[model samples]
Target: MVDKPVPDATRRSEKSRRAIHDAALALVAEVGYPKTTVEAIAARAGVGKQTIYRWWPSKADVLLEAFLDLGAQTARELGQEPYVIPDTGDLAVDLKAVLRATVDELLDPRFEAPARALAAEGLVNEPLGREFVAKLLEPQLRLYVDRLRSAQDAGDVRPDVDPRIALELFVSPLAQRWLQHTGPISYEYTDTLVDYALHGLAPR
Candidate 1:
């Protein structure tokens, strides 16, 4: 009898990794991060625990990477280029467009549950929180910083303004509202935020 062709190792490994990521994300979303475990993820993934151990040191790391993958995957599904802040040369228009997209992402049910779980855990878990910020959140924020710097170069933003701090004006309020459920989130709400942030409260 002819020997069967061997499966491609790289393709097999990638499929397993995607399975592991999905399992980890779903488990955390269902049970919360504190209760999610490597064994649980591995079992859910249909892979051995040793398979997980081979790639990640801990559950936190797995979840972090899983979340990152989820973002990229979700962006692809939405037809967006992940991690990009578009520069249309009109600062207000650019910022508003991005914030509107953010509103849509924050409200997406598939992303919301797992993202909230991880974000909640990051608040009290200092090391995980720091790592989360450093690895995931900060990089996205830096895109805003870069865009603000470019706006400054065009004299759209004041040269003396700090791009980092200026971004917080629009970004932080929406984050607070989302995380705390303080108010509704919508394109309109976010558009208003961009307006107020860019133009200020006093009569324009």
Candidate 2:
């Protein structure tokens, strides 16, 4: 008898994982976080509920990993490294570049809808909110903090300035605008934010 070809288990697993991530994101975007359950995600992904349970403990874990996968995929598509802040010698230019990328990501419909749903849910569900912050937001914020610290070392920022607080000057405003629909987010707007943040409003 002829030897049979071996099945590519890894490739099959990857396909299923991607499907699960996509399904979780879509479900959360369409139904909001509270209504997006593990069973729903598994059904939407065309995977057995047992498969989802085997991979993740809860719906929140599934959603978190899905967002993470989405971010990494987006970064690859953009030809940028995932979860990194650039460190060019010019602090203002570097900040503007990163923030401009952020603006693009925020405006992307694929990212926007699910992100808004999660943020809204986080507001009411304290435990989920904390998990979101701990798993996602805080790590991203640390990137900014690290970049700011480098700028400080180079004397681009004041030694007295707190990197943690300093980063919020630009990051918080952009987040607020995107989350609250208070204003349009554009590359130009983010560039202005970087400039104003690097150079005080009181003038040189």
Candidate 3:
């Protein structure tokens, strides 16, 4: 039996999809999400308007895919898996290491611009905000939840604590600092967050 050749149309579609993602990210970074349009992305991507519409329902969809791809690429570059948080028995050490890497990612030029644009838009655009939180943010956050639960089981964390809320004590502060430029991001800062969260600020 002969091997079947890959379909030319499928190959073409994949190329177009990558181009669209690149174009959408570029446009969002350059002009912000509210100003980026399907037509503009198609033009920049060297594809037709119909091609974008055929693949995605809206510009938000295209941007979401682009952001997700960027995150995966960052994960690969960091020698980390995109979907899992490390659980190395010492919860503070593991959390600090991951967060230090995240600080590097947030400061990366390629990731920062589009991410800032999308995040700013998400602040005011309720539907897009919710979509981003649900699809891109929450899934990543669940990894922390899993790690915390394991820590609790190991007696490394307080059993009565809610993992979801407990994770936020460190995670949300870092997120706010990065997102709003409220403070400096450093290895020390993140390490401190881990220490503060785990040991409690009330002298325990």
Best by lDDT: 2
Output the number of the TM-score-best candidate: 2
List the candidates' TM-scores in order.
0.93, 0.94, 0.93
- Once fitted onto the true fold, the runs of candidate 2 whose alpha carbons sit more than 4 angstroms away are 1-7
Model 3: per-residue lDDT, tens digit, 1-204? 997887999888888888899999888999998889999999999999998898789998998898888888888887897567777789988899888888898899888888889999999999999999999989888999999999999999989999989989888988999899999989999999999888888964
TM-score of structure candidate 3: 0.93
Error of 1 at 43 (Å): 0.6
Ten contiguous residues minimizing lDDT sum, candidate 2: 79-88
Count of backbone clashes, every candidate in sequence? 0, 0, 0
Task: Report, for every candidate in turn, its global Cα lDDT versus the true structure.
Answer: 0.89, 0.91, 0.89
Q: Write the per-residue lDDT of candidate 1 for residues 1-204, one digit (tens) a residue.
A: 997876799779999999999999899899998899999999999999999999999998898899889888878887878567888889889998888888988998878898889889989999988999999889889999999999889988889998889999989988989898999998888889888888889995
- The CA lDDT at 91 in model 1 is 88
